[model samples]
Target: MKGYADRKDLPRFIAVFGCLLAAAILLGYVEMLIPIQIPIQGVKLGLANGAVLLMLYLFDAPSAWLLSILRILLSGFLFSSLMTILYSLAGGIFSLLVMTLLKKLRIFGIPGVSMAGAIAHNIGQLAVAALVLRSVESLLFYLPVLLVSGVVTGLVIGVIVRELLPKLTFLNNGGYQL
Candidate 1:
């Protein structure tokens, strides 16, 4: 690994990473506070995804990935259980990959990418559920509802990111190029 001294912008990079991670975790906590009253076990507002999407757009994939992982770990430790971390890890990785690929392809705007990511995230968690329960048939029955939820939540998150990105002028205007 290169020394921090060799990279003049290492501090800036770390600062962005820290800020985004904090934002992701904080938003995730806020999501927990605002109960959705949904009956399904895995359905979530996914409000934290907005920060992850912003990280992806503002930085490279690797940085975005790190943010996702760190956010999951910290949030898991502070708020939830090991199982939550496992499910989130799976979903977040899947969601990030789908969003990154769609963005790279440039075939879809942020909303399209967000919707795809949302669905992918649910699919990922469903896969984990099937593995844990050893009942594919029962889990398969729950897929559609999760998919629909993912789409709705993902769109909401994407729209939030799109709207917030423009307002963050310091980050967008090259005040910090991380």
Candidate 2:
């Protein structure tokens, strides 16, 4: 398992995590500022996911997972409600798991992984919504819209990552560099 086993790796890990966390928070903030509204009640552009995808490619799975969780928590406190936090946790955790698994399989590029994550995120959030509302009808009603939005948002995030990756000299597959 790849991890922070060496003392020398700690600083790089902290630095990378800090940068990605800040980027994720900033993206989340920017997404909030945008007034575009979808028909769905809980769907947004998912711009912060770009940082998650970038971290996944630049670091190990744990780092990506950590960043995802931190982004959810910090962004939630800063810009969203408690309910939003719950939905975000469910969606973000599910999305990260799917993306990490897809990335490990190495059969898909960033777009594919991101799309899977986005779809999974919607499903996860819908599942929570269903539980909270105690209505299967709500899930049925939102499924199509959420799924479509998820794919579009995921593709956008993936494209951003693809464009940004080549220019990020600090990212090394073997390990992160400061």
Candidate 3:
């Protein structure tokens, strides 16, 4: 694999990364607009993850990590609170790590990778919540529901990424054939 330093189209890479970051932020805002109330707190479609997954597949681990962190920080600052930022940072890191590992393993498709990411994200948030509450009981009660939501959301994001991949002419033009 060629390193970022070895790439000839650095400008193109930067532009693509910027576009992905914008898409993630936009998706985050869109998700916020749709007030889907679940019984559990902090559970949503995670639509922004589509951009993250797309970055992971089209770019590399470092790129994906950077984008995820930026997305979490920016979105949290713009639309949420400090506490939300903490939870989102934790979840985003965990999710990205899991997704990157799964992607590296090459044993699963986009849906499987996305599902694992979603599950890991929930687990990360739950851990933080448990720590804050000084007990896991309340959060534990919501695990099953969160897991199901994760699966469904992950599948949807994965399918969206898969469909979008073919239409990304920039990636193809950059000489990185997906």
Candidate 4:
């Protein structure tokens, strides 16, 4: 119940990890298939993040953290470039840290935590963008727009996880001690 996986739950933990990883990758592919375009590049629905959130809530921070990194690497190799990997790695790390903190605080529900995580993701990505461009001002100009997009997309993913969690009662309760 403490969310750490024990020997008895190790197999289940691995299974959950594998399943979440698959879901994240599949969601990333789905996101790629969707043709939602914004004026600024790199803005996304963050569909894959849903699985990472689920892992965080269902198990523990380390589980979610691992999922986030693996998802980025796999999705990057499967669907994008080295730059894409770097950007995603940055965003994913920032997003997971904030989300884990908020979740630990118990101050916000999934929606609020997710929204904050999304903003963090944008900030992280923008930091990388600034580094790549060697221009902080240019990336700063995109902050407001990126924040707005993060709010919208993060809420979408949050609402979805909220709805989806209830349906997974088996996983939530009886699946494992992990």
Number of the predicted model whose lDDT against the real structure is largest? 3
**Model 2: lowest-lDDT 10 consecutive positions:** 169-178
Q: Tens digits of per-residue lDDT for model 4 on 117-156?
A: 9989999999998998999898979988899999999899
Worst 10 residues of 4 by lDDT: 169-178
Task: List residue ranges in candidate 1 displaced over 4 A.
Answer: 1-8, 172-178
**Against the correct fold, how does model 4 do in TM-score?**
0.91
Which 10-residue span in candidate 1 carries the lowest summed lDDT? 169-178
Candidate 1 residue pairs in clash (backbone atoms < 3 Å): none
List, residue by residue over 73-115, the lDDT tens digit for candidate 3.
Answer: 9999999999999999899999999999998888888889999
Alpha-carbon runs more than 4 Å astray in model 4:
1-5, 175-178
Q: lDDT (0-100) at residue 171 of candidate 1?
A: 61
Give the better candidate number (1 or 3) by TM-score. 3
| Alpha-carbon local distance difference test for all models | 0.83, 0.85, 0.86, 0.85
Over the stretch 41-120, how does candidate 1's per-residue lDDT look in tens digits? 78898877888888777666777788888999999999999989999999999999998898889898788888899899
Model 2 accuracy (lDDT, Cα): 0.85
TM for every model, in the order presented, reads: 0.89, 0.91, 0.92, 0.91
Q: Between 1 and 4, whose TM-score is larger? A: 4
